[model samples]
Target: MENKIAFIRQHGIRVRIHALLVDRYLQTYYDKLGWFSDPYEVFRDIVNDPDKHYIFKSILAKTNVSKFDLPNKEAYQDFFGVNPVSSFKQLSSHCSWTGGCLLEKLERAISYDLPGLLSSVSKAAATPAPAKAAPSPPPPLPGTCEGPGCEEKPKNRWRKQ
Candidate 1:
């Protein structure tokens, strides 16, 4: 709100905006906010803010980020697509459901205090995780010899002959 008034005051750009037409005025500034008129960019920006993490964090933890780090709008659309990013309200009367919520509150970020959330989400945004090492064989049985060059005898066969 302050930004809109400041920009208007600074540049001397005239707008016939009023209580009802504010949405129209806001739409003009959408590109400047960095969506690049592309939903993929919007998704990218919203996911990284940590505040908006709730909107997509579950998907991040469960799936490879690469599955979503699409290169363009077409690819993003073809992937697990979403509802219109445009219609997502900055403040909604009914926010607890999908495709509706408080944009500012959502993007303001509450995960900074959570190491698991920060590490998983932010690091994944930056790069893929390193591969894990294979597990070592289980410790030898109680009666079996342990350590290098030690081999256990075979159990009795053929009813001890």
Candidate 2:
């Protein structure tokens, strides 16, 4: 649990820094409004703008896909090999306001399948482990080792030490 928290903290810092760098680059090249925009600006915009908020949520849903969708692990690897955010941004550029109908399709698909997907995941996770078989009885104690009045040595006598 501590390891997971530490990882999340480190990952969050990297994401924050990357977002800052991207914001700085865009402002320098596109906006030229230095100090006026920062990493928090986009976040603030997402909070303030209802449409942008939903767009961001839709993109998040798209990346967290169903595990069953891919045939092989390689296919899963290839699917996530490309950055979904970059793809969404590029695809969304086709429409300035809401990216034409892509956002709608994405939201619709998630809404349609998320419940069943979540339910299946929950069911699989909740399934109990198989019961183990009872252990075989121990061999009759040495010396008392049974074989119709046999005379096997005691176990302690067999120890090399």
Candidate 3:
């Protein structure tokens, strides 16, 4: 964990809101900012995308995304990949905001049936952990031998005059 933290820090990554799940669309929300190298790049793509103009908008509209609450690159792809230039609400009639937990919510949002972007995450989670073995006893310390047959330092006898 320390190494991972150090690596992230050394690489100039920041934990930003990657995506806002269920904020507008059921499949719309994401982890809401994660460790990102250039978080604004994500924001720029979304706000600038000609397709995303309706879900996101000018000062006159209520937007589903924010600078801090933006989706990762995958969600953007999937959103557009599924249906570009069309509202996500038309995707389905399911309206359960609180169906799954955070992880499940993320899985649902990103883990597509096809080998899409988040397939790695689902694959990892599905993989079973290796079994653990029992720990062995510690070794004995030095200079503390007291059993029989164990040698002790030689003792000198008194010299005769």
In candidate 3, stretches whose alpha carbon ends up further than 4 angstroms from where it belongs are 1-48, 51-54, 57-66, 72-79, 82-92, 96-161
lDDT of 3: 0.42
All models, RMSD in angstroms = 19.9, 14.8, 17.5
Kindly indicate the candidate among 1 and 2 with the higher TM-score: 2
For model 2 the local lDDT of residue 56 reads 30
Error of 2 at 67 (Å): 32
Clashing residue pairs, backbone N/CA/C < 3 A, model 3: 16-33, 17-32, 17-33, 18-32, 18-33, 18-70, 19-32, 20-29, 21-29
In TM-score terms, candidate 3 sits at 0.20
**Per-residue error at 48 for model 3, in Å?**
7.1
Candidates' lDDT values, in order?
0.40, 0.43, 0.42
Where model 1 places Cα greater than 4 Å from the true spot, the runs are: 1-71, 75-101, 116-143, 151-161
User: What is the per-residue lDDT of model 1 for residues 44-153, given as tens digits with 9 covering 90 to 100?
Assistant: 55433423333234333543333233233243333324545455433334467666554323233321323345556566668956878979988767776676778656
Residue 50 shift from truth in candidate 1, angstroms: 26
Q: Please say which candidate is ahead in TM-score: 1 or 3.
A: 1
**Candidate with more favorable, higher lDDT: 1 or 2:** 2
Tens digits of per-residue lDDT for model 2 on 1-161?
44444455445444433333333323333332356766445443433342433433332354543333323323322433443323323233434564455434444444554445556767776898798997999877655646668765557866775
The candidate that wins on TM-score is 2
Order of candidate numbers by TM-score, starting with the best: 2, 1, 3
Candidate numbers sorted by lDDT from highest down: 2, 3, 1
Q: Please give the lDDT score at residue 68 for candidate 3.
A: 45
Model 2 weakest lDDT span, ten residues long: 83-92
